[model samples]
Target: MIVAPGACRRLKPPYPYGSISISFGETLFNIRTDNFILGLTFLAPLAILFLNILLVFKVRRILFERKMNSSKKQRKSHISLTLTTLAIMIQHLASGAKTVIGIVRPELVPYALIIRHRLIDLGMISVPWIFYISHPMFHEKTARVSSFT
Candidate 1:
């Protein structure tokens, strides 16, 4: 289905209470809600950010233990993946905080805008790195399994 510019693709049922949409320039940033689910949506990214941190830690440990054993190509890939994970996690956390603060305080909208713009940039750059990391990890895991078999 096609969605028009500035229109949300998902249709949410309206609550008995009124809700507002937060907009910056042409884009609708978020929909304000008194409902718990909406509040959870604002907080969900924070949880993902934490997960990313955990993955980074795990990846770092692997890299550290294998530093001497792994080839230059593998080590470089690990470094790039870890750094990208870290940067994305930071960007997600900051953006989530900005969104929560914006909704709760409404006065921090400007700060939220700055955070949103930064996230947009981070998303553009980090998505490719995520795939980069995943592709190698997938192949490595497959190779290990095949050797075991």
Candidate 2:
């Protein structure tokens, strides 16, 4: 899950620099040096995305079914959660596509690498926003504090 540099490199002489080193479980996949492993790395995220889509659809259906009987705040929370989930799923797919493209198409690696960190930052920032909007308590506290001001 943790993709960091200098984690592990199995190349005979090791990669020169700026290589994609992904650590999953006990194995380290060095994409720049290993073509076969690079191609295989694509499967993990694709599989995850497939599973996520199915789960998201099921969750959305359940949320919608209970929407009619839920209070306004509950409805808002459900909507926020659904939207956040979809946004995250899309982010995951985009990241996976970028990784695959970077590995398969060497020419595009420069471009893909440039946006990688930005995408990660976006994902990190969105997590708190999702929690804030989806939690009723946060909204209530904000509303109360705003009323005092």
Candidate 3:
């Protein structure tokens, strides 16, 4: 019976967040939270970006190596992989940029958060488009005509 596992919830956890302070003569921004969420949020995307850079470099080496024959299919595959990386990277950048802008210039956060959401959504929407076109199940299977009607 795995109905309720409140085994760890009974213990009181200590707050881990440290105050974020930015000051120009006087303090412009000073906020503190119980959880150190912002650090992870920022670092997670950064890690993805680092991985993306490595992937791109590896793909580039495969494409441009002296002895390797770079065919149309390989180029197309590389392009698709690069495009996917770019879409994901841009999405992460947009997400992180919003936070940085909010911290530096609180007045200029694009008014409504919907604008930021849309920018992020655009990147997310583009990543799947490549998959939709390339996936075999999604493509129509043409019947080979043995006898002409």
Candidate 4:
């Protein structure tokens, strides 16, 4: 079921009287209700940030090891890829942190929302350019067509 953000603030007990009571012979136990969404909301962004960091390191290592043998054109492509990846990672981290902080602290919602929206817009615009610049075939075809013209 879909749960609203406000619904998480006020919790209702599983039972009718707004309290859960358990009895085993003469023993009695009571437990407080917790919002699962709040926990998941906080954890999701952290998980994404961790995965992004791992990806950054792997890409950096691969780029470093391959740099020595690559030609000028290949080196340029690698450098473009490296810069694009770093930019994307920074955007991801900023957005993730904004989300986590916005959820945990409502006071920062407006600022976080603005930052997140701008980051998303920036990514949308830059991704196509990154793909165009990184594709080796695109450059080769352009050069061939340009020579004919």
TM-score of 3: 0.61
| lDDT, residue 122, model 4 | 85
**Candidate 2: stretches off by over 4 Å:** 1-40, 141-149
TM-scores for candidates 1 onward, in order: 0.55, 0.60, 0.61, 0.56
Ranking by TM-score: 3, 2, 4, 1
Model 3 ranges off by over 4 Å:
1-35, 66-70, 110-112, 134-143
Candidate 3 worst ten-residue window by lDDT: 6-15
Cα lDDT tens digits for candidate 1, 1-149: 12224432332333233434532223234433345655675778878887888888888898999998998668767777777777676667766777778778876666566667778687768767675765455445343444554
Error of 3 at 121 (Å): 1.3
Residue 100 lDDT in model 1?
A: 79
lDDT for model 2, on a 0 to 1 scale?
0.65
Q: Which segments of model 1 are wrong by more than 4 Å?
A: 1-34, 126-149
Cα distance off (Å), candidate 4, residue 12:
27
Per-model RMSD to reference: 12.0, 8.0, 12.0, 10.5
Q: Which one wins by TM-score: 1 or 3?
A: 3
lDDT of 4 by residue, 4-93 (tens): 222222223322454433322221243222346556655665676577667767767777788887676766666666666656655666
User: Pick by lDDT: which candidate is best?
Assistant: 1
Pairs that collide, model 4: none
Task: Report the lDDT tens digits of candidate 2 across residue range 1-149.
Answer: 33534455443223346465544433346434455556566776687778777877876787789888878787777667666766566556667878778767866765665576577677778867887768676867443444554
